[model samples]
Target: MALRTVLSDPMLRMLALAVLLAVIIPVGSQTRPAADLLVSAGVFVLFLLNGMRIARSEIRLGLRNWRFLLPLLLWVFGAMALAGMALSSLGQGLIPPLIAVGFLYLGSLPSTVQSATSYSALAGGNLGLSVISAALVNIAGIFVTVPVFFLLGGTGSEAQIGWESAERILLILLLPFVIGQIVQGWTRDFIARHGRHIIWIDRLVIALAVYVAFSGAVEQGIWQRVDASAWTWLGGMVAVFLLFGHLGSWVVAGALRLPRPDRISFLFAGTQKSTAVGVPLAAILFPPEIAGFLVVPLMLYHLTQLVVAAPVAGALRRAG
Candidate 1:
């Protein structure tokens, strides 16, 4: 699963390189605070840019299209999250507790924008809705994922969202986003001028966060804990998740009597998990070592989605 994500996307390849760098030069405890500060700044900028670029009309479009959007909401956060919880419950003795918690984390995340959008386009899906769905969920995940994670018994006492964490989220994530929206009208040309380059900002932050998170895990002996059997278990469990994600989304959308393009949007939006949202947020929410353990399932699910999405999109195209 790890190798697959690394192989599938250039951005993910950079992320893989980040993991390698973490392994080689793990951030010591002394340096972690500085690293955390940098990551927080990057996340603030990333979401700020997101707010600037995403037009308000698009958000309203997603909201008014409730017939298609509501089921998508249910399948993504509701069904997928439940699946992760059930699996997490089942894997108690079968896997490490953190990795089991990782399932719920992975399930709780929003869809990746690039993959879901690209695959939706390839499959002759509704491009506008796909784009909007991806963006909305990515934005919404910041607000939704952690609460849902804790509600589902993601961890014990150490895992609750302390007031400190909530305040940080509001300050870093929410505040910047609101500020960006406020200034977007004035900064339209500035954003348009460098919009393409802004994605690098997002990628760099995710990479840095991934590096720091894994550095903590390396410090905690991640490699030693994840032995041969654990790898095997991880592979099988992730496959089960992949199947459930793609197949279940499709089946549920069809059962909802969605037309093909809308159904395709549902499939793509429901199936993919965003490292963009997941890693940076995890860095903020969990301690570095715990964040590292939690992202393992996410890393695998992320790249594997790239591997499977092309073929799935092609199949959908053919069926259409």
Candidate 2:
């Protein structure tokens, strides 16, 4: 009956956002830069607010577990770098670099606190390890990503360094996390007291972000070049990449004689890519057309990985 009730249910909320995005199709044809900037800023707020719920202690512990953390970090960066090179070999030029950067960002990002912890728990991983790993990646991304962008030649060249695109991303993402950590020291009890209320707000923010992002893309006329066939290839490639990434992580884990819990952590967290982080970064770094094509694969992959990984994770749990 209530607006929050209507928007806080995950399935219904996501569907509602998707429909909102669909309707934005017509509105997008005429929206101006001011409107687009406003929408982007809204999404950026969600990014910051999401970090506020996480405590600083969780982050500190996530960093201290360097054995598991270090290897996973290497795997993420290595896989992304290789993916870039491999795609280039297949004759995909600008799109490959964009995608590689997406994958790299994927690698460098902190694990989804809820999703990673849920999967790790379901698949029998070390819970503390999962928490720490997620925190470490996110914290590291704040520092690592800036240097990475420069090292990968994302400086004053094309994306326009003077515009402070990289700085904006860091400010939106990293600044919030650090602030939350500082606040957590004093407000831990208060935060925990209102945790249930916070959950609904969190969902609302995510739903709004999804709506804004899709709408902004529509506003930019990104869908013009996206055809049915293009979507199909994107879907197909995502499926292939998901299978390969999962298997690759599994093989590496087993070869290293990792424990069962560690292996499961490696497989799911390592293989599942984040479109939330990837889409915004792509939008910033690439021309509209190039970003559109590059984003197609990630969106498909994001959808398919959840569908496919759920069953696979369940099967693994049953076997164990």
Candidate 3:
């Protein structure tokens, strides 16, 4: 199969990711920092575009589902905390907690709209619930992330919660989302007529963001702190985390007597973390050096889950 064809396969996104990393490995070391920052800044627009496409009503509806959500949130965070403890016992020390905390926040993060809806539809989840869940998570991100960060020791124990980054998220990500909602309502016919063209633009923006962020991370020599053994450990950790996330979600869904469809939604949506969201958030959360380390486990997890979950999701779809 051709390279693009292979990449389009969810199972192969990991291979594509490997290629992305390989390209970044050598050149990332030599790139200028300013260029990287500019690119990173530019990537935020994709978040905006995604936000634009989200319906405000979805967010409003999310409040009603807090009953279903609160328990799931607790389960994910609690499990991650336990996993962090396990990692620490295994000589990973503080790294595991850091990774676990990062992941717990990652778990708490807003769900992806398209993916959640698609998976929910395939797996027999409440379509409205999926939409509302995604919106709620994102809206909560604006209000809850900073406090959660402090609670989880992400921003340090004494770190004062501020509105600076949250404001940026609102401006950079939320503004375009609101505009998109307007566009959808006001010029629904026009957008429908040009929807295909707009989608391509959206994709282009996302690709540009990925390239720029990777390049910036490279230019910053972020990989210098990681060695071959660390890579090996990370690879193993990602695999385990992927396994744990999916299986744990499945078990929990079953234990709760959730229907098959809701189980599927819970299994995939709850377990899947978005690098698209995580990377930029990490940069905003930490200094370059700290962000680099903080993000590595998440980046690894993001890639692994995509690669593994794509096939799993597809299989679930086919079976259904």
Which parts of model 1 have CA positions greater than 4 angstroms off?
A: 1-8
Q: What does the lDDT read for residue 148 in candidate 1?
A: 84
* Candidate that scores best on TM-score: 1
After superposition, candidate 3 runs with Cα above 4 Å error: 1-6, 9-44, 60-62, 65-67, 73-108, 124-128, 156-167, 174-184, 187-191, 197-213, 219-224, 287-289, 314-320
Rank list by lDDT: 1, 3, 2
Candidate 1: residue pairs that collide = none
lDDT tens digits, residue span 1-320, model 3: 23333357442354345338635552243453653465346545555455555666665666666656665666544564455335433424433334434544454454555666665775567777766665555555555555555565555421233577667656665665566666656655665687667666544444444444454445555456455666677677668767887888789888888767767777766676655555556555543434444555666675565567656766777777
Candidate 2 to truth, TM: 0.76
List, residue by residue over 49-98, the lDDT tens digit for candidate 1.
87888778788888888888778877888889998888777666777888
Better of 1 and 3 by TM-score: 1
- For model 1, give the 10-residue run with minimal summed lDDT: 1-10
Candidate 2: tens digits of C-alpha lDDT, residues 69-179: 787776655664455334323323323333333333333333345555666777777767766676566556555644554555443233334446656666666666566
Candidate lDDT scores, in order, read 0.85, 0.56, 0.56
Better of 2 and 3 by TM-score: 2
Error of 2 at 220 (Å): 4.8
The order of the candidates by TM-score, greatest first, is: 1, 2, 3
